[model samples]
Target: MTNPEYWYNTRTGEVEKGRQSAWTDVMGPYPTQEAARNALKTAAQRNENFDAAEEAWEDEWDDS
Candidate 1:
């Protein structure tokens, strides 16, 4: 059997066993409850990393 998925409810800051909240108010289908619980932290880190990468890419192609 496959492992159950967990989701982080952004609206309520709760870790749910499945898609218990609206899609727009949830973070993910994490493999574990702990991972789901840290969803906001993970998303923030990912956003920071993505912004850094995008900045580097833009700098590489800057003509001025």
Candidate 2:
């Protein structure tokens, strides 16, 4: 059988074994409890990385 995925409940800052909260208040299908627990941190880092990449891409096309 497949293992159950973990989810981070944003509303209560808890790590759940599976989907147990409203979709709007949860953050994942993370592979482990630790990952789910760090969901906000992970998301912030990813957002920063994506923003940096987007800025670089735009800079590459600027002629001025």
Candidate 3:
């Protein structure tokens, strides 16, 4: 029952979560949890690299 630490990357327009430091395979520390995720999101998006499911992208589609 927590905020789950989310980040919004302006560079890539991607949102990411920490999911816990251990499972995330991260170093000791970075900036704020939100900052860390934003950094990763920016990097991934810069390379056009995405790991989430295709269904997830459906929300971004415009039906209107």
TM-score of each: 0.89, 0.94, 0.24
Candidate 2: which pairs clash? none
Residues 1-64 of candidate 1 have per-residue lDDT tens digits of 8898999998899999979888999988999999999999999999999999999999989956
lDDT of 2 by residue, 1-64 (tens): 8999999998899999989888999999999999999999999999999999999989988945
Q: Which candidate is the best by lDDT?
A: 2
Evaluate all candidate structures by whole-model CA lDDT and list the values in order: 0.93, 0.95, 0.50
Q: Could you list the CA RMSD of all candidates, in the order they appear? A: 1.4, 1.2, 12.4
Report RMSD for candidate 1: 1.4
Model 3 per-residue lDDT tens digits across residues 1-64: 7445554444444444643334334432334665665565557675564545444576567443
Candidate with best TM-score: 2
